[model samples]
Target: MNRLLLYVHFNKEDSLSTHVIFQLQALRTIYSKIILISNSHLDRVSLDKLPYDIFLQRNNKGFDFAAWADGMRMVGFDELKEFDSVTIMNDTTFGPIFDFASVVDRMDSSESDFWGITNNRAHSADIGGQLRPLKEHIQSYFITFQQRVVAHLSFQYFWENVQSYDDVNQVILNYETAVTNYFIQEGFKYGVQFDTVSEDISNMQNSDFSIFGVKKLLEYRIPFVKIKAFIHNAEKPEINTIFDEIVSSSDYPSHLIVDHMTFADYPDRDYLLSQKTLDFSSLKGSRTRVGIHLHISCEDEIESFLSSFDQYLDNYDLYLTTSLEEVVASFDKKVKEVILVDRGINAILAWQKIQDRLVGYQIAGHFEESSFSDAIDSLLKPAKKIVAYATINEKIGLVVSDLTVSTRTEPIDEDSMWPYMAQLWNMIYPHNEKNLKKQDIYVRSATASFWYRPKALEKILSIDLNALVIQDLSAMATITHSFSNLLTYVAWANGFDFRFSQPHLLTGFEVRRRFESRPFLMVEEPAILQLKSSKAKRIIGYTIKRLKTIVKKLKY
Candidate 1:
C-alpha cells in the first residue's frame, strides 16, 4: 500500500529530540514517503540531518494545523491525491509504541474514507470567536485520509483557505475539529480505532483518554500517546504511573521519556518535584564521593553550625569558604580545604572560587552563613538521603530543601525576582529563556542551601561572577536571589533531574519503620517466616487504613 506521512515538529531548542527521531524511524516502515515539516528555528545544518525524504521549514506562526496546511501545499494537490493514503501527525505525541506497520495494516482493512486512532466526542467549545456545540471529530494529532478524500476538491479547498491564527484554540476549533466535520458532511465515512463511547462513559470524556486512559490505550495496542499525558494533569497519581506503564508495556527506549521530561515544562512544579525526588532512606551509610562546601560569613554562628552537622561530618570531606580570619582560626576537624574570598562576596561567588574542587565527587552540597542553623536537625535526614540517592540514581543532579526545612514562613515571592533571574538565565542559556519562562519553572532554596552533583554545575560555573557583582551590593543581592532560583533551571537545562528535599516530614520512628520494612521483605529467611512477616505487614496496613476510615466516619 502506498502511504504518505506528513509529520509536523516544533522544539524551542531548534533541534530534533530523541523521541521525534525515533518516531520518524518507526514511521519509515509503514509510510512510502515521509515529509518532516518544522516550525522551529532549525538551521540548515540541523535540517540537513533530519531523517526524512523531504523537509519543510517555516516560521512558527500557526501551530500544527498551519504546518499541516503548508505541508499539503508543498506536496501539491496532484501529487498528494495519487497516494493511496495520507497521514498527518505532529510531535505532540510520544510514540508508535506498538509497531506502525501493525497499525497501518489494521487501518488499511477499514472501509472508512477517513480514520484516526481516537476521536474528540461531540462537545461545546469556543469556535470562530464564539461558544457553540460541535460534532464529533477525529483529533488532528494523528489522522489518516483515504485517497478518495484527498482527491476530492473539498480537501484542496480546505487547504487553500487555511489561515494562520495566533490562538491555538482557533486552530483546534476552526481547523482540527472542523476538518473532520467538513469531510463527513461531504458524504465521506469516518472511523476511529479506539472509540471512547464503547468504554466506560460515567464521568469520562473521550478527549481525556490520551491522559487518563493511557494504560488502557496501551492495553488496546494503540500506536501513539499524547505528550500532554506527562506534561499536565500532574495532580493525578495516574499521571505519575504513565512513565512506568509505558516502560513495562513497550520496547520503546525509556530514556527518551526521561530526557524529555527533564526539560519539558510541567505546569505543576510540585508534581514534577515529587516525580524526581530521591528518597533512599533504606541505605545504611554514605559511600558515594561526597563533599560539603560551607561559606561562613557570620563569625558568631560558626561553632554552632559545625556542631549541628558533627554527627555526619566524618562520612564526607568538608570544604569551607570565609573572609573572617577568626572563622578560619577557630574551625578545625574534617576540614579538607578552605578558601578565602572577598569579605562581602556572596555564597555564589564563594562557590565559584572553589569550582576547581567540583571534580571526582559524585555529590556536592552548598551552604551559606546561618542558612541551616535554625533548622539543623531537620536538615540531617535529607543530607543522608541525598547522599544515598546520588549513590544510586545518577540522573538526579540537584535537590533543594523544601520550605518547611527553612525559617521562611511564606512561599518565595519569585515574581519579584523573575526580572533579575531572567537576565541571569538569559546570560547563561540564551536560547532557552523563552521556554524557561513559558514553563513557569521557577524553584529556589530560600536559604541558598542545597545538594547537587558536580556535573549539574557545569553551565553555572561558567557564569562570570566578577561581572555580576562589579556594579554594587544591590547587584550582588539581586544576582544571589536570581542564582538560587535559577539553579533548578540550570540543572534541568543540562539534562539533570531536579528534586525537592522534604525535611522533618516524618518522625524518627516512622522513617526507621519505613526503611526497616523494605529490608525485612528482602531478608532471606524460611518460607514460613517470610510469609508470616508479609502477613503481619498486610494486617498492620489494613488496621491503620480501617482506623482512618473510622475516624472519618465518626467526624462526619
Candidate 2:
C-alpha cells in the first residue's frame, strides 16, 4: 500500500535523538512518503538534509495532538486521500524492537480499518467497584488507519476541530480517548494487533509482570514499545536485568535507551547502569551546540576545577568570564572563548555578558568551580533553569550538615532589607510576577551555581546587571548587597523556573570511607530474584503458608 506517515516529534533539546532517528529509519521501509512535525525551535539550515519533509513549528500547546493537527493541515485536504493508508506515530516509545514491515503487512491484510500493535484499558477503577481497568483504546504511540477509515469525515473533523488546552487531562479526553471512540461509534471497527489488554496480560496488582507480555509483543512482531513502561517499574529490583536482556535480544540500540533515561530520569539510570549491562560506546547523539559559562574568581580552586572538568571535556566549548590574563594563560586548550569581564564584575554581569556571546546554542550552562563537573549534563537539561545541588560552601551554613547533598529553599527575612531588595527584583524590566509567585518567592539558597536556558532568561540579559543595584555587589555596601544569593530568584522572576540537579554522591578528592558491614542474615541468590515462573513461585508460597498453618495448629 502507498502509505503516508505523519510523525509528531518534540525534542526538548531541539536535536534529533538517536531513538527518533532509529524510528524514522525503520519507517522509511514501511511508508511511501514521510513528513515530520516538530515543535523544536530549530533552524531549517541546521537540520541539514534530513530525508523527509520537515515542518518546524513554534506552538507547543497540545503536545502530540497539536503536532498531529499541524501535520494534517500541512498535508492539506487535497492530499488526504492520496495514499492507500495513513499512520500517526510519535517518539514516546523506544523501538521498532523487531522489523515493522511484517506487522504492517499483517495489518494490511486484516479486515480491521484502524489498528495499533497493542490496546490497553487504563487502570482507573471500573463500574464493578473492584479495581478493573476500563477504556480499551489502541495506545496512541503508533496508530494506523486503512484508507476507508482515513477517508471518513470524522477523521478530518477530529484533526481540524482539535482544541488548545493548558492541562494534559483535557488533551487526553479530547484528542486521544474521544477520537478513538468517535471512529468506533460511526460504524467503523477498531482493532489491536495484540489481543491481550493491559489488565489481562498481567494482573493490575503486579504490573511489573507486564514485562513478559511486552516480550510477546517483540516476538509477535509488535514494532514499538513504550519508554514509559520501564519508568513504571524503575524501582523494581529486577528491572535492570530484564531491560538489559530485552534490549540485547531485540537488537535495538542500547545507547538510545540508556542516554534517554539518564536525562529523562537519572535515578532510574543509576540502577540500570550500576550493573553496566548496556554498551554506551555507540551512543553518539545528533550534533548539538552547547556553550558553558564559568567564573574564575578564586586562584586556589581553578586547578581543582579543571582536574574534575577534564574527565568529560568531550568536544564542548568552554566559555570563561574572567579578565585576568594570568588566569587565561594558566588555562590549557580546553578554554574555547574567554569573555573578558573586569575582576570586580559581579556574578550577574559575568553571566549576562557570557549569554550575549552564546547566541544560537541549544543549551547553555553555568557552573561554579566547586560544582561537580558531572553536573554539566544535569545542568544542560532542557528545563527553563536547572541548578546543581550546592552540597558544600556558599549555602553550606544554611544546609546545617556537611552530609546534606541538596540545596534547600528557606524563607527570607521579611522585615529586614530583603523585602526592599525583593521589591527591586520585582521591578526588574520584563519580569513575570505571576510565575515568580508560583515558585518559592523567598528562596535563600542555590544562587551559587546553576544552569539556565538563555531564551528563558532574556529579561535578565536585557538588564544591565551593574545598574540593578547601585554598584557591584562584591563590595557588600548594604545587608542586601548579597544579590548573588538571589540569582535563583532572578531566573524565577523572569518566568524561568529551575529544577534541582541530581545530588552528587561523592567528591573528586575524597575516598569513600569504608565501614564494617552491619549485622544481617545472609541469603542465597533467590533473595535478589527468582528465575522461576509465576505458577512455580505461587506454588512455593502456598506450600509455605500451609506448612506454617499446620505448625501453629499442632502448637495450639
Candidate 3:
C-alpha cells in the first residue's frame, strides 16, 4: 500500500483554494490513505467537509509548515512502515491514476533507494555536489519515497537542518539532484515513470497553463484543485456587466450606418484638407482670397483636412459649403469673411452664390457644379488662369480653355516636378503617340525653364513651373535645343548680348546669358549668385577628392 501526504503553504491571496477541495475529494476514492496539511482556516473547513484527513497549521506567522509536515510524515511513515512506499504531493499537484499502484510496486521491488515519477528534474551544481542533467525542473514539489527510508532517516532529520523556508526548499531541490546523480554513479537502475497518471492539480488556479493541457488532465480522470485567492479584488460585477453591454452595442452593425455621400475615409480627408490648405497658403498674398466649394461627397475628408488648414491660414478669407462643425470653426478669427453653405441646400442656389462671389479662380476637384465650362466661363471674365492640379486620368475632358491647368501624376524621376508635366501634356492631348516632329505641344526641361524667367516673382514661381515643363521631355537633346531657342528669343527681347553653344564657355558672355535667362528660375542678387557659384565649385572639388580617396582605399 502507498500512502499519499499532501502539503500546501498559502496566504489569503493564493488562487487555488477551491481547486484543492475537489482534488482531495477525487483522490480519497483512489488512494488508500490521503492526508492534507494546510495553513489556511478556510481551506481546513473546506477539507473537513470532505472524507480526507486534514492537518491545520496553528502558528501561521512563520514558514514552519515544511517542518510541521516533515514531522507528520515521519510519524506516518513509522506507522506505515509495513507499507511499500510513501508519496508526497503538493496541493497544486493532481493525480495518481493508470497503473500508479503498479509503479509503486515496481519501485518497492527495486534495489534503488529513490524512484522519481516525473521525467522532469533539475540539479544545481553548487548545492547538489554532483549534478544530474534534467529534462525540465519539476513545476511543483511532489515526490514518492520508499517508506523504509522515511521511517529510518525521517523527514524531521531533514527539517532539523533547515533554518528557514528558503533553506527547506533548497534542501528538497538538492536532495533530488543528489539522488539522481548518486543513482547514475552507483550503477543502480532507478525507475522514472515518464507516463504518469497524475497532473499538477492546482492548474485551474494557474492561468499560465495551456487550456489543452488542462483538458487533457481532466480527460484522464485525474483529481485536481483550482485555487483562486484573487477573487476578493475582482471589480464590482455591475461595472463589468455595463462595460460588456457597451462593447456589444458598439459592435452592432445598425449603430454604425454611414451615409455614402457624407462618410470619408479618415486618411483621405486628412490628405485632401492638408493639400488644399497648403496650396491656398502658398499663394502670394497676405490676405489670400480663396474660394473652396468642396462639393465632393467626401464630408469626412473635407472636415478633417480643412480642420488642419484652419490652424495655419487664419489670415485668408474662405468661402466653404459644408455642415461639418470643423469647417465652421475654421472661420473663427482667421478669415476676413466666411460663407458656410449648407450641404442640404439647393445645388443651383449654391452655384449661383459661388459664381457671383468667386471673382478669381475657383479651387475644386472633380466637382459637377465647378466643371470645365464653369472654370472657362470664370476665366473669360478677366480672372487669372484657373490654377488647378488634377489627377492624370481625372483631368480628361476638363478643358480649362484659357486657364492653365496644372495636372500631376505619380513621380517617375529624382526630379519631383516631371510627373506633373507628363500628366499635363497627357491632359492637353489624351494620346500616347511618341512622334516628336508631329506633336504641336513643345516640351522643355526644368533646367531650360530655369533660364527663361527673368523677373523676381516670375523667376521664383517659374522654378517649380519650369521643373514641371522640363519633366515632360524624356530626352536631353530635345530639352537642350528647345532651351537655346527660348534663351535666344529672351536675349533678343531683353537687349542682352548672349548666346549658348556646345562645349559652352563659362566666360562673362555665358554668365551674362545665364543671368539674363534666369536658368533654374532663381531671383537672387548678383553678389548672392556669385557666392553660390563659388560655393558650388568648392563642394564639387571636395566631392571629387573624397571619391578618389574611397576608390584608392577600395583598391587596397
lDDT of each: 0.71, 0.56, 0.35
lDDT of 3 by residue, 1-556 (tens): 5565555544443323333554465556546765555555545345466555555544343343353455454555456565555555655332332335465556567775556544433322333464534323322344555655555554435534433444544544545334445334544344544333244535343222212133333344322311211122122222222222322333322111111100111111111111111122222322323343333223445444445335433332344544455645754454334456654433223433454344342222112322323332222121111222221112111112211112111112213333343443343335533211211122211112111112211211222223433455454333323332232222222222111111111344444564466532232455334444534443333333323323333443
Q: How close is candidate 1 to the true structure, as a TM-score?
A: 0.63
Error of 1 at 217 (Å): 2.5
TM-score of each: 0.63, 0.50, 0.30
- The runs of at least 3 residues in candidate 1 whose Cα sits more than 4 Å from the true structure, single-residue gaps closed, are 127-129, 205-208, 267-320, 323-338, 341-486, 493-556
Backbone clashes in candidate 1 total: 0
Higher-scoring candidate on TM-score, 1 or 2? 1
Q: Which one is best on TM-score?
A: 1
Ranking the candidates on TM-score from highest down gives: 1, 2, 3
Better of 2 and 3 by lDDT: 2
lDDT of 2 by residue, 142-231 (tens): 788888887888788778888767677666666665666778888888787776654454333433222445555555656666777667
Instruction: Give the count of colliding residue pairs in each prediction.
Output: 0, 0, 23
Tens-digit lDDT track of model 1 for 354-414: 8778666888888776567533543455567567766677767777765431134332334
> Measured by TM-score, how close is model 2 to the native structure?
0.50
